[model samples]
Target chain A: MTKRAALTDLPLVLDRVSLSAGATTMLDRLNLAITPGAPTLVLGPNGAGKTSLLRVCMGLAAPSAGTVSWGGRTDRGLGRRAMLLQKPVMLRRSVAANVAYALAQAGCPRHRRAARTEELLDRVALLGLAARPARRLSSGEQQRVALARALAREPEILLLDEPTASLDPAATRHVEEIILMASQSGTKIVMASHDLGQVRRLAGDVVFLVRGRLCEHASVGDFFDRPSSAEAAAFIHGELVL
Target chain B: MSEGLDAWQLIASGDATLISIVRLSLTVTLGAVAVAAVVGLPLGALLALTRFPGRSALVVLVNGFMGLPPVVVGLTVYLLLSRSGPLGEFGLLFTPAAMVIAQALLVLPIIAALTRQTIEDLWREYRDELTAMGVGPTGRVATLLWDSRFSLITAMLAGFGRAAAEVGTVMIVGGNIDGFTRTMTTTIALETSKGDLPLAMGLGAILIGLILAINAAAWGLRLWSEQRVA
Candidate 1:
């Protein structure tokens, strides 16, 4: 099998990226650079374009104006990146099979997929439910399975959209543990979240957005302790930012 | 009442002629279904996933063809395969092959149209995920088709139901030759014309029973497998 290009597409950069759908602007001249590091948690209000920004970074959505380049290449070679949506869609198959499908798509040889699937499932603490249909699993379990699937791709950059928003405390903790594990293993993590506690626990830095514009980007300590933007200050205090 | 009794007796006794007719019916209908599925499934998947000029018009044409009269299809196939027609040299007219062709033509539209709808809905649910996975066009089609297999089974059965239940196409193409091209539906039609109610009723019962049994088996299999994997 031909080898895929190594994950050298680091420091994903966006240059004045703007996205719009007719009269509605989803992303407004957002400039950001995500370098290799600890997990970066994107915090924003609803309609603040957090999801839209991740979609752009993942190369799933093209910006209407401006450009996004991975490393230095403008072409979207998605082999080195994987993403988890707010509500991950489980394939209509077994949990093990769902991971197996991702491995197969990632070009893992047929002979090695089974062992790899087991390993990934075990990492997510879902080895016991390997044979169960993935779609029938609880939402928390599904999120973990989605995490396992994203891990299956062996991505250099992992982008997640609200990976644990709907989970109970226990389940949310489980997911966070897996995410932390993934980050420690050298994969760059960029995730969006609504939970403030989650943001404190998982974020190395915070990218705060308001109405499709980037309002603040700072280290976790600085952002929460001394937020420069009025919007970020109000948002950190749980005041409505409208 | 006597005719019903005779019909039940014929069915119970497994008369040679009745058995032959039933076997031919299954052979012809299943053969047609196989042919239709081979051509229709991919066509349907393509229609669902791709966009091009005149695609809507083509979709409407396929949908319209689903309601085409079997006799009309038979007539068209007859003209194509008749002795004086373009395919005259092969001499397939009045044979089971001709009947299979006619029935395949009649059933293809139903299978294709239904498959298009099934794959389209599945594509909607799977679009973002599959695209995110970087699955290409052919992979997208294969993935959607395999994932939609349960729904597609119903589409195939609908095609089988149409082919098995229709006499007009087979009668025109097969000539209903006894011990040869005669199928359950064609036999019932011929026997009814000759006032042989018992024989017609026997074949009719077997036809209905066969359709019901196949449908039930498919439903059970789908339910069982879906529970296991869905």
Candidate 2:
């Protein structure tokens, strides 16, 4: 029912981070810092390791080299963190129950669950469908429920991997509005997206990745106006960059 | 057709011996399923969620055991419950309790292996979501098992069917004690051996019908729950 207390981890820093599976490199010697305030957007083409980068930030994947630290600590518990995958998984239960499950996992009390679930479903504009089976819902609806579930944790850092990649225009707008509102409320959104339009709308900072390498990290205006790397320039012009 | 009609008559008339046998069959099979579920569900869930060096080997072992010979299970249990054997202190041999134990042993692998498969499939879908919710390993297993319960119920029913249809284990362990541990399967075996063709046919028909009923009830429950969930 209650939001998480103020952020304890800030200025999330990645140092020489590399990830490899077998002989294939996924992320290569990436060094970056994400300071508090403003939503950071990660952009890259297919197979550029956007998802892997988000997973590393969420502590879901281990890096083969270097380290990622949240506020100078790598051992902090992940209870205050939440990540949304590209295709969100819906629990085999009612929409409200999915949110309640998250709330219960976060140790919210039984008495508070009903109100909290109501608030979350309403927040996602899914209150009318609260009793519907989550998996039976449309993809866009399921994505909204996933967002509500993530918010149920009251996370300090929300990592999203193309959370709206499959949604229609209207659905995408709804999700973007919610993400923007969460950003304004200081949840500290770190999202990876393929939608340049979405990037233009929500990105305060942009981290451009190419073939698992960090090509550019700059404020959205600067990155768009005076592109630092050839890859960034090519990507901006809608040209494919390998 | 004549034997089936006679069976219908026996069932309609509620013959005492046939009723007792049917009741015992249900008791032993249901008991076996209960015991197997208690042990197997958690074991299956553990196998699904954790990774260890021999985990694949263990999974293979459990899967292999699903086809375990009921007669062999009977002999093993019979040996264990024999007077001079290790578990003989409880003196469970040649009783309905022994039959239940043997059937439970026979059914355990069925329940556990099916549970492992069902929960593993559900886990693949749920892993990211649950992990993001900060569910630790144990909680994730618990959640998955609970969510996949309808399928697990189907698994239990499969075990129940195997237990009820099995005569080998109950025959060896129960000794087919008339008016006591003579369940439908054992009684059918006994009647057929004694050349009582009509009684054997009747009991066989009843056994098949009872199993069909159980399956129908279980399927109905699954459908109802699914509808509610949907």
Candidate 3:
């Protein structure tokens, strides 16, 4: 299916956001705007706060100094959003039940839940294993189930943190395809990734972080070809950004 | 012992007094379990999910209560139910109702503490997913309790075992009135004291059987659920 226009809201805005613990800063005065379109990728080295950034946007963590507004809606009103964490947790049930639980929590009507669950599992290529226990699945399969769960929410903004970090190349390809499809269908995709090759394939725009600071935000082509910041340049060249 | 063999013969003969004792034992313990579950399940879920000042201290207190001496509980209940005590107006001392109350009090802490541990471990795994799904605090607790249903069943069984086996609480509160409030544990105590070794041994065997039956049932449920999940 082709990506549809966003149904909930447009342009998640973060203004002067900062998350700090004691003296350690995780996200420092970062500002950005995300509108529905192509996928946006967040890239940074370990401890650079890539995961923390996604968490803040998901409203799992409060920004110590700034505001994150989803079309003027606060976290309580952001119910139409769903996130897949770096280490996704599977509900202790059948694969289909995991997706269905998400659907139920999202307020999907009871009568329609089964069909929705089947469709989501099919989209993630997990239909055959619908009756299998979710936690008993392989790590790659579990990730797919987590993705299926996120899609079951019919979310406008889908946040993913290293969704394919544990997958093999074949599994990674399958996941990347579904992500691209979701982006094409107009579900705004915001993701954190360490694999540069993946960024090349999925990112429409790139947000680069260096030690809790927003070093650069650029379109994939511009960011790759022109390379505005030294960190982005070094990062693209496969050099670690401290 | 030859007395153990004779006790089996009494069980086989299905003596009326033995039947009444067994029935009473089941009633009192099951009643205690039901009452404890009503209060303990919510308390445990609350303790597992919420955080406030003194929570740690409260958790320690509940854990400590699990090891409460049955004789102390008996004396405390006895005093409260005596005509000179605060709750004397109820006139519940030396009755089955009093026995149920004492057993419920003893079982509550076991159910609550085990439930807290089980649900807390599950909450750790489920917190992010449930939160991202927009589930509220109540929803989180309900979901964790359901997902951890197998472990919670074991907790209930543990409460039942404690309730059924403890003699001090029921003996003091029920007064071990023959044919009126006599339970298997209390009957065993009376018969043993009267030197009727065979009957006491029979009641003891029946009590052990009931406990084993409960554990076996819980084990079966765990297996069935595990298979269904897999």
Candidate 4:
């Protein structure tokens, strides 16, 4: 999983970032930098700000305390980066069209969007359902479509918040393969997953957040085997760390 | 009995009043629904998607207006357009334009409130997905509208039904001016009051037909959405 791509400065940098919603801070003074081609997974218990951290990085939810600089710019121009959610959002269109819309909105040339959509659909095992209405698909198929949509952007960074939170075993395996394929193609993936086993299988690096604070950042092997913090240790043992 | 059958001959021969009334009903209802759509849809979208202190109050107000009495709305507009009222200079009362205005007012709240309900209900399910998908604010709002398009279509058709069959509002505002503001409902009322039972019954029959057409379309949309969901 540590097959790094071409070298660059940080693609996503969050400096002392904090998120507060109506007097409740979700992420507080958390500084982190994710580089090009790095697959970082955020893992913690319920209400541990894992999803909030992903949002701050994506500019969907603004951080209050500090800055988030993306590719040397602190702006919404980084919208080209894509994201996936646990509950897949499908439009009233064909699955291919959903992927195409993501690429097209990111300014991918019209001629290329179709080809890219088809390729991603194949990669996600949704090629057969390309013509199917996205809204008509089962939850698993919809998630695959969502994954295809995210990768079609050919994003410099991909953010996922519990993309497989509620799937059966077979569906989870299918989505995991799709994501693993996307990461192979050099998409920098930052994800949040409650499934620690999936995190172990997929993550190159792990970020541990607790009560709006980042407690640990380590290589996946190190974090799972010899967690540095008491919080991380408690979490590693099947206890609610939050 | 022989004269009673002549009403069928009038329908067969394409009677001018009958055709004109049908055409007028179509245009006035369509025109009013268009205006209400333009005004109420965006308001509904905003009310549903936005968060502010008065949002609940606004929702209550829009929902409350869904039950507003049509005649009361028509009477209010008639007063406003009367020569002595505030906007009397326009001389709009007793014209088809006034009828259109009154009808649009009557349906705007219904469209707005129902559209808001549809979008809000949809937002509850998909807002998190939309946010995580990085759909911009505009796209999120537009997506909710598009996703609930079937529901919106039915809401609009319901609004059209309300506009088409409405009697008191169009009667008061239009003055049932023959060959002009006269519509199916108003004509039916006029014919009924004048003891012209045959014409009144014919118009009533047409009104029922129009209602059937609208309900059929709305039901079709609902069926299509369900089939897709399946």
> Among these predicted structures, which one has the highest TM-score?
1
Q: When superposed on Cα atoms, how far off is each prediction in RMSD?
A: 1.9, 2.4, 3.1, 4.4
Q: List the residue pairs that clash in candidate 1.
A: none
Worst 10 residues of 4 chain B by lDDT: B1-10
Local accuracy of candidate 4 as per-residue lDDT tens digits, A101-159: 77765556888877888888888888898888888888988888888777765666888
TM-score of chain A of 3: 0.95
lDDT, candidate 3, B91-141, per-residue tens: 999888899999999999999999999999988888787888878777787
* Candidate 4 lDDT score at position B186: 82
Please give the TM-score that candidate 4 achieves against the real structure: 0.84
Give the docking tier of candidate 2: medium
**Better model by DockQ: candidate 3 vs candidate 4:** 3
Predicted candidate 2 versus true structure: per-residue lDDT over B154-181, tens digit per residue: 8999899899899999999899888888
What is the TM-score of chain A, computed separately for every candidate?
A: 0.97, 0.96, 0.95, 0.91
Q: The CA-based lDDT of model 2 is what? A: 0.89
Ranking according to DockQ, highest score first: 2, 1, 3, 4
- Candidate 3 docks with a DockQ of 0.66
Candidate 2 residue A203 Cα shift, in angstroms, is 1.1
Give the whole-model CA lDDT for all candidates, comma-separated: 0.90, 0.89, 0.88, 0.82
For model 4, the superposed segments whose C-alpha errors exceed 4 Å read A1-11, A20-25, A109-112, A237-242, B1-16, B50-61, B75-95, B131-138, B197-202, B225-230
Residue range with the least summed lDDT across 10 consecutive positions in model 1 chain B = B1-10
Give me the runs in candidate 2 sitting further than 4 Å from their true place.
Answer: A1-7, B1-6
Candidate 4 structure quality by residue, lDDT tens digits, B1-230 = 12354456667888876788888988899899999999988889899999999899999999999878999998999999988989889999888889889999999999999999998898988765665555677887788887788889888987988888788898888898988898888877877787888867876887788779878977887888667543
